[model samples]
Target: MADALSQFEHSIYIGSYMSGILYGINLVMYFLTLQGLLRKTNHNSPKSRRFFAIYSTILLLLITIDVAVNAVWGELMWIEGRNGPGGVPGFIATQTAAWYQTMGSTAVVIMIFMGDALLLYRLFVIYGSKYIVIAFPVLAYLAGLSLAIIELVIAGKPGGNFFHGKSINFGTPYYTITISLNIIITLLIVSRLLKLGKAVSRALGRDSAKMYTSVAAMLVESAAPYSAVGVMFLIPYAMGNPIAISFGQVWAKIACLAPQLIVLRVVTGRAWGREVITQAQSNVEFLSNGRPVVHASGIELQSHGTTTLGDAATEKWNSSTKSLGSS
Candidate 1:
């Protein structure tokens, strides 16, 4: 029985450690992408930027906290031992599980708050013309801030320690108000995009019309995939099975994160946009143009108002000139 229990712990620890490593890599990628975008206006959607900022900040904070948690789990409790690379430039293992888990739980709560903020921001951005732009962010701040206080203060050290372990339960509310709110928000986004699409499509012939239309289409297209995050996380939040639950939760986080990464990859470079086949085709054409040509009529290296002989002609000149000089 002891051996079986040890095996189970080992399996779970492996999953947790792998998840931690993946989380660290994801955070690094997000930070680099966010820094590059902030310096340049690569995207137009304010909601998107707001979400990126929120996501990047919260994820970074979580990465820090989890690094500590993984440390405690490995050295003190967990079976496999989290004794690999720290994944950061300089991270040392010192904190206790009590402290690490507490901080990590707090960070997780902050992320949920950010998710709510993002959903509401989407509404505000979509309805800015119809309503006050500041209202959404303001309301979001109030709601998230208040809930955050509840999570931080009322449920201190949420990782099965604080508030008689009420923190984890509340910290991870799945089928409750939070998840419902997310679903409703998703529906609202879909509805708003539908309305916005018609307006943008009206000016289809104009160059600018396509821009807004594309935005609307993209917003709509990405909505469903983004909502999948809610569904995945909410399950673990509500009735998490500890094993299957966390797997889904991590996947949800990745889903939320990957789209933004894809967007960053797309928006950053224009001339840098050619695929491998495209570049290969261009190179093929360029090299074929360099092939020998008898006629100099269609040449590109125009110099001194005269044509430079092609490869075939140059060869002929070398033979004739050499023979005459020898004579």
Candidate 2:
């Protein structure tokens, strides 16, 4: 039992240790990217700053909690002479983790509900009709909270000397709730992106903007598969098959780390995107009398607009005015 426990213990340690390292990398990138975003945000505008505040708080708290509970707590739990209650099971370890666990509980509270609300806000960008009326961020909150509470209350209790290959088992359908939410949210976001893509295609008649959105959607889509995989990792742990689940975890690790980087990059690259937007091709045409007229290519951003620019420029100016080609 002890060896079986030690093996499980070591696997968990490995998983969390890897998770902590990735989280550290991601948190640093998030911070750097957010620093740039903060500089651009209108500090006085409540709406403009809300997302930054919320996601930032979550990332900060996640890092803190993960470090305190998973990393620090785990280390301390074993440090007190391995088979004994010396390290994390000791007073100092409990104190550090107890507070962070409480904070994590709070963070999860917001994430379960408010996070989904904030995510669905993007639906306004895609849907032209009443589809979003079905959205219930409040419901998401309630369901998520209920699931979290159920996990804590119903799961079995931890065994004696928590470090010596023994733990409390608390199995429930909590992850099912979480996974269902993932599918729901991913589908929502992808649907919105699709609609937004078509609208942008129709309005801007351009590819650059679409390329950006497509890349973003690709990044988002990449998440669902990986999330599905990562959540599976929890399943084995939750269901008492932890050893069978540990071998092929690279996907989960990459899934968790890569999305954060992609999101951070997009946030940082927003300025670059705007700069591209502002630099759309422009030209001035002249009447026979030499009066200047303004014309621009359709914002559609083809690598080469197959139509002749000279003729298109002349035609654009002509199309915009009552007097062009009249003289």
Give per-model TM-scores. 0.52, 0.60
Q: For residues 1-327, what per-residue lDDT tens digits would candidate 2 score against the true structure?
A: 557656666775776766667667767876775675576442223353455445655655645553455555555456643555553234333343255444543443343344344334333222332455435633654565676664443222232222112222322344455556655666765655554444333333446345435665544433455445546655565556645324223333343344445444445443112222222213323357533333455322234422223445435433332211100
Worst 10 residues of 2 by lDDT: 318-327
Question: Residue 26: error of model 2 in Å?
Answer: 2.5
List where candidate 1 sits over 4 angstroms from the true fold: 1-25, 28-35, 38-58, 79-97, 129-165, 168-175, 205-226, 244-327
lDDT of 1 by residue, 124-196 (tens): 5444423564454455456545655665664443233332356455445432455556555667656655554
C-alpha positional error of residue 111 in candidate 1 after TM-score superposition, expressed in Å: 2.4
RMSD of each: 17.9, 10.8
**Candidate 1, residue 80: how far the Cα is off, in Å:** 9.1
Clashing pairs in 2: 76-88, 77-88, 80-86, 80-87, 155-170, 157-168, 158-168, 205-300, 206-300
Candidate 1 vs. true structure, TM-score: 0.52
